[model samples]
Target: MSKKEKSTSVNKKTLGRILKYIKRYSFLVVLSLICAAISVVLTLYAPIITGHMVDKIVGKGAVDFGALKTLAIRFVIVVAVTAVCQWIMNILNNKVTYHVVNDVRTSAYKKLEQLPLSYVDSHTHGDIVSRVIADVDQFSDGLLMGFTQLFTGVMTIVGTLCFMLSINAVITVAVVVITPVSLFVAAFIAKKTYHMFRKQAEIKGEMTSLVNEMVENQKVVTAFSMEENVNGSFNEVNKRLNKAGLDATFFSSITNPCTRFVNSLVYTGVGIIGAVMAIKGRISVGQLTSFLSYANQYTKPFNEISGVVTELQNALASAARVFELIDEEPEIAEPADAYVIEKADGQVDLSHVDFSYNKDVELIKNLNLKVEPGKRVAIVGPTGCGKSTVINLLMRFYDVDAGAISVDDHDIRQVTRESLRDNYGMVLQETWLKTGTIKENIAYGRPDATDEEIIEAAKQSHAHSFIKRLPEGYDTMISEDGGGLSQGQKQLLCITRVMLDLPPMLILDEATSSIDTRTEIRIQRAFAKMMKGRTSFVVAHRLSTIKESDIILVMKDGHIIEQGNHESLLAQKGFYYTLYNSQFAH
Candidate 1:
C-alpha cells in the first residue's frame, strides 16, 4: 500500500482504540452529541428569525412593529437556549475526555507491569513515563477540542446549508462551490503534518529521557566534572527536538489560516450572489440577509474544524505512542497449570542453561549448578561475569535461552513467577526505595507486618540508630531516591526490608558493597542470622564477605572456573586463589 494509505489505516486503528475507551462513557458521549445538535439548531434559527424581523421593517412608516416584537422575543429565547446547550455540551465533553484519559493512562501503566524486563531494560525510563503521562495529557486535550468544536462545527455547517437552501438555492450553490477549497487545504496540510507530529512526539520522548537521566545522575556528572560534556549531549538532543517541533508546528499551523482564507472567499461569493438575487426581486432583501448569515455560518465551521483537525493530528500521534507501549509483547505467560509454591525448600538447580542479552553475543553457556536447602552458596566473579545474571535467572526476571532452572526439583518456568519470587529475598548493590517512611519501606515485603516487627527488623539491620537520630525517627518521610540518606543508610534500609520478611531463599548481590566497613560488619552479622536455615546465593566482590560460605563458585567468562569450600579452593591455588589474595594484597 502507498504511504498515505498506510497512514490512513494506522490513524483509523488509533481512532478505533480511542473509541474503545470512550465507549465506556457512551451515555455521557450521547448526551454531549444531543446537546451539540440542539445548540447548532438553535444557533441556526437565530439567523432566520433575524431575517424575518428585518422584513417587518419596510421603510420605517410601513414597519410591522408588532411582528418585529414577536420575532425579537423568539430570537432572544433561541440565543439563550443555544447558550445553555453549548454550556451542557462542554461539561459533558470535559467529563468524557478526562475519564478516557484516566482509563488510557491506567491501562498503559498496567501494561508496563506485565511487560518483560528486557523490554523495559531496552527502553529509557523517561520515555516510558512520557508515554504514560505527557502523551496521555496531549491526547486528552485533542479529544476535548474534538468533542467541543468538531461535532458542533460539522452540525452547524449542515444546518446552515439547509437554511441557505430553503432561502435561495442559487446562493447556496455559490456557497458550495468554494467549500471544497477549504476542505482540500485542510486535508492536504493535515496529511503532510501527521508524520511530522509523530516525529515531534518521538523527539520529545528522547528529550524527556535525557532530562530524566541528567536529573538522576546529576551527582555523578558533578563528581566527574562532566557537566560540560553532559550539557553538550543534552544540547544535541534539544536541537533535534527543536527542529522537529518547529517543523511540525509550522505545517499544522498553516492549516487554519489557509482554510479560513478559502472560507472567506466562499462567504464573499454568497454575499455577492445573494445581493444580486435580492435586487432582481427573485428573493426579498430580508431573505438575502438571512442567506448571507447562513453563508457565514456554513463557512465558519470549516475554519474551526481545520484548527481542530490540526490538534487531532497531534493527539493521534501521541495516542499512537502510548498504544505502542500498551501493545508491546509481555513476558512469556506461565503454563495453564503452573504450580504456586507457597513454601519452597529452596533447592535451586541450573542444568545446561545458556543465555545472552544479545543473541549474537554469547554469555552464559551450558551453566550448571545445584544448591541444597539451607546451604549458603557464594558466587564470586569479576564485574562482567554472570554473577548477577544467575540471580536474575533464579528470580525468573529473564528466562534462559536453553536448558532449565528448577527450584525444589521443579522447573522454575513451570511455577508461577509471583510465587517463585515470593520464596526469594533479594538485595542488590543498587538499592531502590520508594517515597515513604522508613517503617513503610521496611514493611514493603510484608505490608501486614506489625510495627514491632518492622522496628525489630530495622534494629537488626543496624538502621535503627540512624533512625533515632532523625527528627521523626521511623516516620520520617523520604523521597524515592532516598533523599537525605547516605548510600550506607539506603543499603541499611534495603537490608532492613529483607530482614523484615526473611524469605526462605536469599540472593545478595554485592548487598553490602555500599556500606562502610564498620556498618558492613554489623549488617553482615544480621545477614548471617537471616541466612541461617535458608538457602542463599551471595554474589560478592569482597572475598572476605563470602569466606564463611559453605561453598564458593568462582566464575570467569560465564563459566565456573572453580567450585569448592574456601580452604579447598585456596588449596587449589587457581583463579579463586588469585582473587582472594588480591583483596588483601596490600
Candidate 2:
C-alpha cells in the first residue's frame, strides 16, 4: 500500500484502540445515558404541555383553570427533575472523564519509559509534551462533553420527531424536509472545521516546542544577544497558529447560526401551512395551535443536533492526534522469550559490530573490543567519531545493526532490556537531577537504599562536603533539573547518585567534562576508588583521565585502530601516541 493509505489505516487502528480505552468506564457511560434519558423525557414534555394548554383554551373558548393548574404542576415537576438529573450527570461525567484522562496520561508516560532511547532521540520533546498535555486534555473534552452532547442530541431528535409526527404528518413532513439540508450543511462545515482544527493543533504543538526551546536556552539567547531573532521566529509560528485557530472558529461558529436560520424558515412554513388547513375546516383550531407548538419544539432539537455535530467533529480531530502518539512504534523492544540476567560479571565483548543511526552513513563499522571482568577500558576518539555511540550501544540505547554484544557470555539482545541494563550504572555527559533533596538524588538510583547507605555513597563520591555546606544539606531541596546547583556540583551529585547503586558494570560518558581540572582530578580519584574491582567503560577526551586505565583504545571512523596499555601505546608513536602528543604538547 501507498504511504498515505498506510497512515490512514494506522490512524483507524489507533482510534479503535482509544475507544477500547473507554471500556473500563462502561458503568459511568450507562449512568450518563440514564441521566440523558431523564433530561430528554422532561424536555420532550414541554411542548406537549403547551399543546395541552392551547387545546384546553380553544376547546372551551376559555381557560380550564383546574386542567391548566395540573399541566403547570406537571411541567414544573419535569423541569425540576431534569435540572437535578443534569446536575448529577455533570458530576458523574466529570468524575469519569477525569479517571479516563488519568489513565491515558499514565499509560502515555509508561510507554515513554518503556520505549528505547532511539525513539526519544528521534522525536522532539515538545511534540511528546504536546501529546501528553494538549492532546490528552482535548480527549477530556471528548469524553465528558462529546458523549453527553451526542447522546442527548440523538435522543432529543428522535423524541421530537415522534411527537411531531403524532401531531400532524403533513406539518411534520414540511419541518422534517429541512433535516437532510441541515445535515448536509453541518457535515460540510464539520469536514472543513476538522482540517482547520488539525492544522491548529499542529501549529500549537510547534509553538509549544519553540517556547520550550526559548525557556531552556534562555542563557544561550542572552549570551548571543539573539532575543530579536528568537522573538521573530516565535511570532511567525504564533501568527500561523492564530490563523488556523481563526479558520476553525469561523467554521464552527457558522454551524449553529445557519442551523437556527434554517429551522426558523421551516417553522414559519409550518405555521403558514397549519393556518391554511385550519381555515379550510380540515383541522380544529386546537390542532393547528398544537401543531405550531410541536413545530417550534422540533427546531430546538435540530439545533441541538447541529451543535453536537460540530462538537463530535472536533472530538474526532483531537482523538486522531492522540491516537497518532499511542500508535507510534518504538524502535526497540524486548524479544518475546527474552531471559532475565539476575547477576552479571560484566565481561563485555563487542565482536565485528557495525552500526548506523541512519541509512547510507555508518557511525561504527566492524569494531571489535573486549573488556575482562573488573577491567577499566578507556575509549578515546575525536569529536563525532562514534565515541558516544559505543556507550549508547553498550547501554542498549540502540541495538547494533550487525554483529553481537555479549556481557558475561550472554548476548545482550537475548535478555530482557531491563535485566540487561540492571547491571550497569551510567553518568551521562549532561547531568540531570530531579527536584528533591541531595539525599533523595543519591537515593534515586536505589530507592530502597537506607539513609546511612546514601550518606556513605555521597561521601565516597566527594559530594558530601559541598552537600553539607548547603543550607539544609541532605534535606535541602533542589529545583527541577538541579537549577540551584553549578555544573560541577550537579555532576558530582549525579556521580554520587550512580555510585549509590553500585551496579556491576559502569559507563561514564564524559562524566567529568563539566568540572574544572582540579575538581576533575578530585572526582577522578573518587571514581577510581569506585571503579576498583568493577567493570567500567570510560569515554573521555582528556588524556589525564584515562592514563590509569587497564587498557586504552583509540577509535576513528567507528573502528578501533589502536589498543594497548597507556605506556605501551605511547611508545608505539601511532594514533594513540599522536593524540596524546597533540593534547599534552599544547
Candidate 3:
C-alpha cells in the first residue's frame, strides 16, 4: 500500500481504539456532561439577565431601585453558581483526559512489548516511539476538549433558539435560516482538514525516525564521513513535515474566520429586521433590544462549534494511528489450549522442520536435529546460512511451517510460550544491558537473586573480578548498553546474567565473537564450566571455539553439509575440513 493509504487505515483503527478507551471511562464522561449542562444553564441565565436589564433600563423612565437591586443580586448569584459549575467541569475534564491518556500510553507500551520481533524488524524505533508518546498525547484535544465544546455548543444553540423563538418567531426564523449552510460548510472544511492533519502526523513520525537514527548512529556517520548524506536525508523529511504542517494550519485557519463571517451576516440581518419592527411599533423597544442580544449570543456558540469541529478532525487523525497498532495480531502468541511445560530436562529435537520469514523463499528447509540431555552441540555456519534460524526455532521465536520441535519429549507448540522460554538462558551476540548497577545487570535474569548468588554467577562467567575492580564494585552504575565497560566485559556481563538464571537449556549466539582472543579463551573456559550438565546450542564463527564439541555441524546455504565428531569431520576432509583449513591458512 502507498504511505497515504497505510496512514489512513492506521488512523481509522486508532480512532476506533480511542472510542473504546472513552467507553471504559463512561462514568467520568457522564459526570463531565452533567457539569457541562449545569455550567451551560448558568451561562444562559447570564445572557437572559443582561437582556432583561437592558429592557428594564430603557423601558422604565426611572429605575425601580428595589426591583433593579433584586435583579442585580440574582445575576451575581447566578454568575457565582455558574462559575463554580465551570470550575468543577474543568477539574472533571482534566481528570478524565489524564486517565484516558494514561490508559492509552500504557496500552500502547504494552502492545509494543507483546508485538512480535518481525513487526519491530520492519518498523523504525522512532516511528513506534512517536506513536506511544506524541500521537497518544494528541488524544487530549481529540477526546476531552472536543467533547467539552461539543456539549456546551449544543446547549447554547438550543437554549438561544428556544428563548428567541418564544419572544419573536419571525426574527428567530430569519436568524437561523443560514444555520444549515454554516453546518455544511463546517463539515466540508473538517473533512478536508482531517486528511491534511493525518499527513502532517505521518511526516512527523518519519522525521522523528530520521532524527533517532542519526543520533543513535552518530559515531558510524562520523567514522564514514557521511554527515552530509545524513543531514540531507534529515532535511528531506523535515521539509515534508513543514509542508504538511503548513497546509493543515492553513486549512484550520479558514474554519473560524469563515464561520464568523457567516455569523456576522446573520447578526446584521437580525438587527435590520428588529429595527424595522421597532419603528413600525409592531414590537416594543425593550423587546427589539432583547431580540438583538439573543441573536448576537447565538452566533458565539456556532463559532465555537466550528472551531471544535476542526479540533475533532485533528484528534481523529491521531486516534486512527494509535488504533492501528493496537489492532495488529502478534506474529507469535500462545495457543488457546497451551499447557505449561514445567521441569524441563533440556533434551531438544527439531524434526523435519521447514520455515521462512517470507512465503516464497525458504530460509531453513527440511531441517532435522537432536541434542541429547546435557550435550554440547556447536553449529558452525557461514554468514546467512540459517545458523541463527536454528536457534530461533529451538527457542520457539518463530514456529516451524511443517513438522514440530520438542523439548523433553513434549511438542513445544503445545506448551505456553512463557513456560517454554523460561526453560532456557540465552546470551545473544549483541550484549544489551540496561542502565543500572553491575549487580542489577547480573541479577536481571533472576530479580530476586540474592547478592551472594549474583556474585557467584558473576564469578562463574569471569565477570566478578572486573566488576570488583571498578570503583563501586557491585554497586557501580553501568551506562545504557554497558557503555562504561569494554566489549569483552559487556559480553561477560551478559553471560553472567544467563548463568544466574541457571536454566536447563542454553543458547549462546556468537557470545564471545566481540571479545579479544585472550578474553575469548577465558570466556570459553567459563562457558565450558557452565555447560557441564546442561543442554547447550552454540553458534560460533570461530572454529577453535567448537573443536571439542560432542558433535560439530558445518552448515552452508541453509543446510548441514557435514556433521560428526571433530576427528571424524577432519577425516572426511569435506566442507568442515575446507572451512577449518581455510581459517588456519589465514
Candidate 4:
C-alpha cells in the first residue's frame, strides 16, 4: 500500500529466496545451529559456576578449598567446551555461506548464456558482471555474518533467559520488560537502512560500469583527448556513490550503538532489582551475582543481533539485484521436435519479414530476399540501413516479428539454433578472442585440430607470420579479447578459425575491415578460396570488396532499391550506379 510496505515485501521475498538456496545445504545449516546452541548453553553455565565459587568463600582461610577446587575445574571445563563448540559453529557457518554463494554465482553466470541478445544489448556488460561477482561477494559477507552471529545471538538470549528465571523470577521479569527496547531500536534502524543500502548497491554498479568502460577503452579516451571529460563524468558518479554509501553506512552503524545503549539500561535495571531482592533476604548473594551475570549475557545478544541486522539488510539488497538478473526472460524456447540440419543446403530465404528493435521505429518491413545454394550474395548498405539485422535474423539471434525465414525451405524457427548456426561460418568486423594461446584461439571452432592443420589454417589466413613472431609463437598466451594483439591480428585469428573448418555457408560481415590494404588483398584471396561452391552472404561498406559477388543488393533506409550483379547495376545508372561511382570517383 505504501513505499515502505512495498520495500518490506520485496525484502521478505528476497530473503525467502536466499533461504531456499541455503536449504539446498540444509544438513550443514542444522549442524551449525546445533553447535551454536551447545556453545550458548555452555557459555551460560559458566556464570552459575562462577557465582557458586564466590559463595563458597565464607571468609579468609575459612574457605572450603576442596569445593572451590571442584568449582574451578568445572568452570575451566565449561570455558574449554564453549570455545570448541564456537569454533565448530564458525567452521560450519563458513562452509554453508561460501557454498551457497558459489551456487548463486554459478547460476547467475549460466543465466547469461540463456538470456536473449536484446537483454545484453540493453544492459552494460560491466553492470551484469557486477551483479555476478561483486554483488555475490557482498551477499556472501552478509550471509556469513548472519550465520555465525545471528544463530548464536538468539540462542544466547534464550538460554540466559531460562537460566535467570531459574534463579530469581522478579529480576528476570525486570530484564525481560526492557528487552523490547533493543529490538525496537534494531528494527527501526533496519527499516531505515534497507532502501539506502539498495540505492548504494545500484550506485556501486554504476561506478563499476564506468570504471570498466574507461579501463577497456583508455587508449581511445586518451587518443581523443577525452581524459578531462571522462574524469568529469567519473567524478559525478563518484560523488553520488560517496553520498549514497555514507548515508547507508551512517544509518546501519546506528543500530549497534543504539542497541548497546538499551542493553546497558537493561543490565542496570537487573542489578538494581536483584540488589533489592538480595537485601530482602529472599535470595543469597551468590544467586544475585548469578542473576547479574545472566542479565549481561541476555543483553549481549541484542547488541550482536543488532549488528547482524545491519549486515542482513545490506545482503538482502545485493541478493535482490542478483535475483533480478536470474529472473530475466530467457530466449524463446525451441520447439519440442526441433529439426536438426545434419548438412545444410545453404538456401536461405526471407519472405515478408518485418522486425524492429523498438516497435515504434520501423527498421525492416516487408523485407524479402532469396539466396540459392552456392550463391555469393553481398548486401551493401549505408549505416543504419539494417545491414547487420539481416545477419542477426538469419542466425536466429533475433526472431522476425512478421513472416518467416527458412533455410533449405525449412522454417528457421523449426530447426534447433545450435544446428542452424553450426551450418554457417561467420566472421564479423568486431573480433572476439578469449584468454589463451594463439594456437588455441585459432582452433577454437575445431579444438581437435592437429598442430599441422592449425598451422595450415593460420598460413591461409596470413596470421602464421605474426604467430611465429610472437615470443612463444603459437603457444604465446594472450589476454582476454586478444589484448596483446593488434586489431588486424585479432581479425586474422578469427578468419583463421573459419578457415580451419569451412562450413556449408559463410557470413562475412566486414570481415576484413580491420586489415591493412595489403593484408586485405591477401585475406580476400583466402576468402575467395574459402567461399568457393558455398552459399555466402557478405555485408560490407567498402564497395570495392563486393563488386565480384554474384548478386549485389544495394539497400537504402532498410529497402533494397536495386539488386543485380555489379556490372548490371552500373549499367542501370540508378542508385547502385551512383553508389559504385562514388567509391571509385577521383
Candidate 5:
C-alpha cells in the first residue's frame, strides 16, 4: 500500500475471477489456440523439409532440380497456410480482448450504481475512472499480446522438442536441460519487477486522482491564486509516477536479453554436441543440421516467453485493481420485511438517533425531532454544526447508528430507497447542472415532465425570467454544471428542478444563499407557496428567510439546543437570538 511496497504477487483468487470472463467467449479462445497449434505444425515442417533437401543433395553429391522444385512448392504452401493462421489468431485474440474489457467496464459501472455512498466517499473520483477506463485498457492490450504469444510459444516449444528428440536425442537432451535455465532467469526477473509494476499502477491511480481534483476545482485554485502551488503539487505527483514507471520498465527490459543469452548458450551446446555425434556416424550430416535447427526452435519459444512473462505480470497487476473494484462490498441488503411505501403524507420524524462517520468521533448523537405534515422547519447554526448531516440522514445517504427515522409513520429503513427518495425534493446551495439545453436541466429530476410543467416549475423558482432572455431561450445549450450561468442563476435552475418533482417533502440547504436579496425575496415567496401544504426543512444562514417558520431548530454539536417558532425562540433569548443578533445587529 506504500509508495514502494505493493501486492504484486499474482493473487490467485483475483486471477480466478479475471479468468471467469474467458468462459463468456470460450469458443473464440479455443479457436485461437487451434490456430496457433496448426500454425506451429506447418511452420516447423519447413525446417524438416530443408533437412531432407540437404540429405538428398549430399547423398547423390549433386543438386536434384525435380525434388528441389517439389520441396520449394511444399514450402510455399506451408508458408501461406502458416501466415493465414497467424493472421486469424491475431484477429481472434483482439476480438476476445476487447469484448472482455468491455464487460469489465460495464461491470464496474453497474457496481458503481449498487455501491454505498460511503464507498464513493472513501475513494477518489479520478481513481475510480482510472480503474474503469485506463487500467481496463491496459489489461486488454496486455492480454492480447499475452494470449497470442502464450498459445503459439507453448505449441512451438512442444512441437520443436518432439522433432528434435526424433532427429537426435542427445542434442535434444542438451536443449531440454538448458531450457530450465532460461525459465529460471525469466521467473527471477518477473518476481523482481512484479512489485515495480504493481507500485507503478498504484502511483498512476494517485496521479490521475490528483489531476482530476485540480481540474474539477480550477475555479477554487484560480480564486486563491494558487497556480504555482498547484503546478508544484502536480510536479511532485508526476515525479513519483516517472520514477515508478522507470523502475518497472528498467527491470522488464532486461528480461528479453537475459532469455536470449540463455538461448544462445543452449544453441552453442547443441551445435557442439550434434557435430560430435555426426562425426561418430551415430547421426547423419542432415540429421545434425536438423538437430541444431530444432534446438534453436526449441529455445526460441522460451526466449519469446520472456516478453510474455512481463506482459502477464502487468496484466495481473491491472487485473488485481479491477478485481478489487469489482469485489468491493455493495450497499447493505434491503430487509426481507422492509417497508415498501406507496405514498407519504409529508410527516417526518427522527428519534434517539446516534451516528458518526468514525466510531471514536461522534457527530450526531441522541438526536430527536418531529415535523408535522405541511409544516415548515428551519435549522440554523454556525459551520460544522451538522446541519447538512441532518439532511443526509433524512435522505438515508447515511443510516442512523441507532434509533429510527420515519416518513408517514413508516420506518425509513424498511422502505425501498427509490420510493423514499422519490417522495422528497431537495435544492442545495451547490447547484448541479449537466451539459444540456436549459430546459433539460430544470426537468432533470422529472425527465418525463411536459413543457408546460417545466415552464411552470421554472417560473416558480424565477428561473424563466433569465432563461427566456438567452439567445435560444429554453433551447439554449448550457455546458457542464451550467457554465454560462451565474451562481445565483444555477441555484434557481436547481430549485426549479425540485419544483418540477413536486414531492411531498422538501429539504433546502442554503437554497437562496447565492441569490441577491431582491431575487432572494422573490424565490422565498415562491418557496413559501410551494411549502403551503408540504413539509419543508430549510438549513439557512440568512435570518430573514425563516422568520415565520413553524419550528426553528437551532443545532450545536449535532443537538437541537433550542426549538420553537421564530418569535418564541427569540423571546427566550437563546441561541437563535444571538445568531439573529450577530447578523442584523452588526
Candidate 6:
C-alpha cells in the first residue's frame, strides 16, 4: 500500500457510530466500569499494606507477628476480590464487543442487499467480504480492549495519585512533572502512524480480493495454463501488503518501547526524589516505599494506554471502511404512489430510450421498439452492440438515462420494482446457482413451487435426466455457481428455473449458447412450446434459432439497422444476410 492506494480516514461521524453502539449496552458498560473501579481500589490495598509492614519492621524495635498475620489475610482478601471483579468485567466486555460487531456486520450485509447491481459490479467480492467480516472483527477487538483498559486505567491512575499525595506531596509533584514527556512521545508517534495503519487495512482488503479471485477462477487459470501468471499477479499484491504491513507494524511497535523509555526516566526521577525526602526526615521510609509503588502503578497504565492508542487507530481505519460501504447510495427510490403490477400481459415498449454506462461513450441511443402481448422478438447483434444493455434496461437493473419503458401501458419506473420484475422470467448466458440442493436452485425463481412442478419443469427443460444420474438425484448439493456442473448442465438448471416460473414475459439472452447443438435443438423445442401465448425476447447467436420468430432485429453500434423476419432480412441481402451467410459460409 502506498499513497496511490486510496485510504479512508476515521472521521467524527464514524466515531459517533461506535459510541452509538456502546450506548446500546450502556447498563452493562456502567456495570463494567463499577467493577473496574472496585478492582483497581482493591489492587492498591496490597501495596498500601506492604508499606505498613515495612513501617512495623523498621520503625519498631521487635517484629510484630500478629500485625504481619493480619496484613497477610488482608492481602489475600484484596487479591481474591480483585480477581473476581476482573472476571466479571471480562464477561461484560466480551458481551458488549461481540454484540456491537454483530450489529455492524448485519448492517453491512443488509446494505449489500439494498445496493444496486452497479455497486457490486464496481467492487471485488473478496473486498466486500473482508469489510463485513475481517474489518468488523478488528474494530470489535479494538473497542473491547480500549474499553477494558480505559476504565481500570483511569481508576488505577487516580487511585495511585491519591495514595501518593497522602504519602508525600513533594514526591508526588515530581512524578507528575515527568508524566507529560511520556504522553508527548506516545501522541507524536500515534499522529504520524494513522495514515500508515489505514493503508495497511486497505491493502489487506485488496490482498483478500486477489486471493478470492484466484481461488474462484482457478479452473479457468488452469485451462489457459496461466497458473504462473495468476501467481505473479498475487505476488504483486502480496508484496504490497508486506510492505504496508511492515510499515504499520514498525510504527506501532516503536510506540510501546519509546513510551516505556520515557516512563523509565519518570520512574528513576521519582525513586531518587523519594529517597532524598525519606532521608531528610520530611517523610517516613514506609511512606517513601508506598509512594514508589503508587508511582509505578500510575506509569504502567499510561504505558498501556500508548499501546491502546495505536491499536485503536488501526481499528478505526477498518471501521471507517465498513461505514463507507454501509453509507453507499442505493438505487433511485420508488415513489409511494407507484403503480403495482401483479401480472403483466408482456406488452413492452421502449420509446426514445437512451442509456450509457459512461456518459461520454454512448451505448444505447434513441432506441425505440414496441411489441404486442404474446409475441416473440429476437435480437441479433454483434458483441457489445447493446444486446445485454437492452436486457438490463428492460429489467430496470440500470434505469434508462432518458425516455421510458412500459409494460401494458404501465411505465416501469412508475411501478413498484418488485411487482414489475416478478412479471418476467429471465435466463442469461451466465448462470448463477447458489450452494444448495438441485431442487432448491430450480425453485429459486418461484420458491413456492411444488416438488412435482420442479421435477416436471426439470424434465421439460431436459435437465431431469442428468440430475437423476447424480447421487441423491434432486437432493444432490450444488456448489457455488454450480461448480461441479458443466456449462451446459448449469444452463439446463437455469432453463428449468424459468420453466417453473411460467411468467407471462420471458427474456432469453444467449440462453442456449452453452448447450451442444443437439441439446440446443431439444431445448429450443421445449422453448417453442413454452413460448406459445407468451411475450418472449430471444437474443441468440444461432441464426437457425430465430428463423421462425415473429420479428428479427439486426443491431449494430447500439442501433437497430434492420428489422424484419429471417427470410425478409436474407432476401434484402443486407447486414443480417451477410451475418447469416458468414456462419454457414463453408
Clashing pairs in 3: 10-320, 11-320, 11-321, 13-323, 14-319, 14-320, 14-323, 15-319, 15-320
TM-score of each: 0.98, 0.94, 0.95, 0.98, 0.95, 0.95
- Judged by lDDT relative to the true structure, which candidate is superior, 2 or 6? 6
Give the worst 10-residue stretch by lDDT in candidate 5.
Answer: 2-11
Residue 240, candidate 6: how far off, in angstroms?
A: 1.2
Candidate 5 wrongly placed segments (more than 4 Å):
1-10, 59-61
Pairs in clash, predicted candidate 6: none
List model 3 lDDT by residue over 287-400, tens digit each.
Answer: 777677777778887778888878877877876777668667765666798888786888888888888888898688878888899999999978999999888888877778
Tens digit of per-residue lDDT, candidate 2, span 190-277: 7677667777778878888889888988989999999999999999999999898888888898998887888788878988999998
Residues 197-275, model 4: lDDT tens digits: 8998898899899999999899999999999999999999999999999999999888888888888898899888778
Against the true structure, candidate 3 reaches a TM-score of: 0.95
Off by over 4 Å in 2: 1-15, 58-61, 281-289
> lDDT scores for all predictions?
0.91, 0.82, 0.83, 0.91, 0.87, 0.88
The number of clashing residue pairs in each candidate reads: 0, 0, 9, 0, 2, 0
TM-score of 1: 0.98
Overall local distance difference test of candidate 4: 0.91
Q: How much is the lDDT of residue 318 in candidate 5?
A: 83
What digit string (tens of lDDT, one per residue) describes model 6 on residues 1-586? 5443333234456778899988999999999999998999988877889888887788446778889889989889999999999999999999999888899899999999889988998899889998998899889888888888977887898898888887778878888888888889888877767778778888888988988988888888999999888889889988888998898889889988887887788789888988887888888777778877887898999888888888888788889999999999988899989998988888999999999988999988899999999999999989999998899999999999999999999889998989877988999999889999999999997889999999999999999999999998999997987867899999999999999988889999999999999998899999999999999999988888989899998989899999999888899999999999999898
Query: Which candidate would rank higher by TM-score, 3 or 6?
Result: 6
lDDT of model 6 at residue 226? Answer: 98
For residues 390-412, what per-residue lDDT tens digits would candidate 1 score against the true structure? 88899999999999999988998
Minimum summed lDDT over a 10-residue window in model 1 is located at 270-279
Q: Is candidate 5 or candidate 6 better by lDDT?
A: 6
